[model samples]
Target: MTGCQGELVGQEVSLYIEDNEGNVIKDEIVTTQDNGFIDLWLPRDHLYRVTIKQGDLSAESEISTFEGDNTCITDMQLL
Candidate 1:
């Protein structure tokens, strides 16, 4: 599995993980580090969607499906 990260300096972004039934399982407000990056972890046997927002700039990652313990990294660029 592969995931992505977003880059936003001194800005607050929201992260959410949803199940296949469109129910929110986890959500949080994350601030990017000095490098403008954040790490995320998702559970197995579930589908997830990730979104990053900073001010008027926001981007969403494609729906990702996980089946086992694995690590995925993705990068989102705020426009």
Candidate 2:
């Protein structure tokens, strides 16, 4: 996540993708590096509840990717 001046370097980030039933379909936990960036590969063509957490801050959103397509999510700036 980016901060006021620049990217929040070397921070812990957690990502969780859950199904409709609230069961975790894919879980990814990693530390951000080189301009607060992390990469994750998730299953395609399915609805998922995406949860992102860092420290006491967090955010959630729903998304579905096209089959066999890779997605990139930008503009996650931490206030």
Candidate 3:
């Protein structure tokens, strides 16, 4: 959430998430918390593609909920 850390807190963004199998998990607007972060709870042991957009900026990344995957995702960036 690099480009989203400070003033972007409480901002609403479009969130789109889908599983590797092409199942849509989430497709809606979400607000960042006080910490300028959005938390998503998905099923475990699966791979997912996530996209977040705020106005003209957007970020997309692949994530996994496997056992050894890092819970804290900090790589997705809005540019």
Best by lDDT: 3
lDDT of 3 by residue, 1-79 (tens): 3444644688999999999999999999999899788889989999999999998999999999999999888778788
**What lDDT tens digits, residue by residue, belong to model 2 across residues 1-79?**
7333326677877878897668897677778766667666666677778787887877787766777544767555553
Candidates in descending TM-score order: 3, 2, 1
Badly placed stretches (over 4 Å) of model 1 are: 1-7, 63-70
lDDT of 1 at 15: 73
RMSD of 2: 4.8
Winning candidate number (TM-score): 3
Q: What is the descending lDDT order?
A: 3, 2, 1
Question: What's model 1's lDDT at 27?
Answer: 81
Q: Show how many residue pairs clash in every candidate, following the order shown.
A: 8, 0, 0
1-79, model 1: which lDDT tens digit per residue?
A: 8533444555678776667688887688887767567766665566666666667877776555455534545445666
**TM-score of every model versus the real structure:** 0.65, 0.69, 0.89
Question: Model 2, residue 52: what's the lDDT?
Answer: 76
Q: For model 3, state the Cα shift of residue 15 in Å.
A: 0.4
lDDT of each: 0.65, 0.70, 0.90
**Residues forming the 10-long window of minimal summed lDDT in candidate 1:** 65-74
* Model 3 regions more than 4 Å off: 1-7
Model 3 lDDT on a 0 to 1 scale: 0.90
